[model samples]
Target: MIARKFWVLALGILMIGFSSSVTAEVPEIGQKAPDFRLSTPDGHPVRLSEFTAKGTVVLVVLRGFPGYQCPYCQKQVHDFLLNGDKFAAAGAEVLLVYPGPPADLDQHAKEFLAKQNPLPANVHLVVDPDYAFTNQYGLRWDAPHETAYPSTFLIDGQGAVFFRKVSREHGDRTTAADVLGELERDKAAHAH
Candidate 1:
């Protein structure tokens, strides 16, 4: 009986792992980015479409307030903040997604942005309440103590994703310089 139970439990765990992986849709390059409307930490509604016409968008997906504040996410945010001028010079706007359970999600996002009071105009931090945007983008980590994988996408004014980096785990992410380089390349291509 004990051996039978062990096999059954193992099967269940396998099924869960498989299902989780199947759920997330990888955002492919050269595809139209999934449009989404989510609110800022202070309850302001912002849509991905709003930035499509103005300039290139640096879309950042974070492992938001999952059971605790992700140190990697914090570092990534700071890295972008440090390179704010560079992003602007590249004609890019950075929009970050903070996702978690629906309940008190805004509050958690608020706490997460506590250090970034009066965020720069080009930097917009939005909350993904109830994982709506997370699921839409197929980035939901779907594991215990995790919200969504860390992903970054560079979208052009035409609304097509030109560059994408989706990290299955923490730490593997696209750097500011990397994104800036892509923007420059895109500009050069267009100029030709």
Candidate 2:
């Protein structure tokens, strides 16, 4: 009976350790954005640090192919693309994350991009197979018919997030105009 109790205590401690290691906290404003590496749709490696030279980095986390291609995700991409010129004018780079299961994630991202070919120079489409980026940012939805909570953050050249929005629902999202306005404000704040 003593041996049995010892084994149970050991297992309990192990479970607690494992669970704590798996959890991550979402970054807040004025905190350095967590760094992660992912590949662009074309199979080229891209890192969050790579965009630091481009001024503000507008990070968009999509729901990915949760159960099917999300229409709201498509519309959000279009909204940003439609304002590509404005983003460029503000010297900002947009990184769109398409996250889902590891199988065929690249192909899924490619097909999604086909809807709006010729992405803007300032914009990049990256795939997060196996939810590495999503998990790191603590945005995983982990429910039936959902993959991740759509989110957006504005990271400055120094990699500090100045603005953040994570939507629990699909419809509400930050628009291009909203990000653009924040970029202008960020610029003004940095100038001083």
Pairs that collide in candidate 1 are 25-138
By TM-score, the best candidate is: 2
- Write the residue-wise lDDT of candidate 1 on 1-192 in tens digits: 999999999999999999876764766889999888999978889999899889799999999888788989998898888888888878889999999887888888888888977777799999987888888888888788889989999998878999999999988988878888888999999998
Question: What C-alpha lDDT values do all the predictions have?
Answer: 0.88, 0.91
Clashes of 2: 0
**Tens digit of lDDT per residue, candidate 2, span 1-192?**
999999999999999999968867778999999999999878999999989765789999999888678999999999999999899989899999999887888888999989788999999999998888888899999898788899999998899999999999998999998898889888898789
For candidate 2, which ten residues in a row score worst on lDDT?
Answer: 19-28
Q: How accurate is candidate 2 locally (lDDT)?
A: 0.91
